[model samples]
Target: MASGASDCHFHGNAVATQATVSTCAAKYQKDLIASGKIAKSWAAVKEPASFEQIDGEKGKEWKVTFKDPAAADKSKESLYMFFTAQGNFIAANHTGK
Candidate 1:
């Protein structure tokens, strides 16, 4: 199915600790993906993941998670997006039904 998801993914690596930003809010994330204007955004977003540090390196896991209960309002389908450690845009349905 074609959706505003799988837009970006950022693998945790040495270079990622520089403090990057991602769309952690489902509604805003989907909106950015649709408009292709995520980069130009300067909004309030917490995180789209959570993680556990390992071997002195950022764990290969999500350290934060983004969500918006309203996405389940039946009027909208939420989207998740982020940049991988390899620096690629990825958006997807993190909540696999």
Candidate 2:
């Protein structure tokens, strides 16, 4: 679904922690597959995701960007997943026209 920029409150200067980010990304990808948005056979997201802290948000919160290989063009199918810093799924969306 199309989303407006106002939907999030992400900020610059994300926390630098590879372990935490990997864990969250794993869970987010799993949840996405479980939700049927991504096929299980695809097995993984097309690229690594970067994490960002949401200003004033409670709990560990991050915004991850990745692509579903089954989707259309990379530009049109770029996907975003939001997760709690502890790796809980929150929301997702597609970018591009």
Q: Which candidate number has the best lDDT?
A: 2
The lDDT values for all models are 0.39, 0.56
> Candidate 2: where are CA atoms >4 Å away?
1-16, 39-47, 56-60, 68-70, 73-76, 95-97
Candidate 1 lDDT (Cα, whole model)?
A: 0.39
Among all windows of ten consecutive residues in candidate 2, which has the lowest summed lDDT? 3-12
lDDT of 1 by residue, 1-97 (tens): 3223243343434434313434323444556656766432323344454422222133242232444444434323233444344434343444421
lDDT of 2 by residue, 4-77 (tens): 22332223345435455555566667767788986574365645546566632565556777656665555535
Clashing pairs in 2: 60-85, 61-85
Evaluated with TM-score, which candidate comes out highest? 2
For all candidates, the clash counts are 27, 2
TM agreement with the true structure for every prediction: 0.34, 0.50
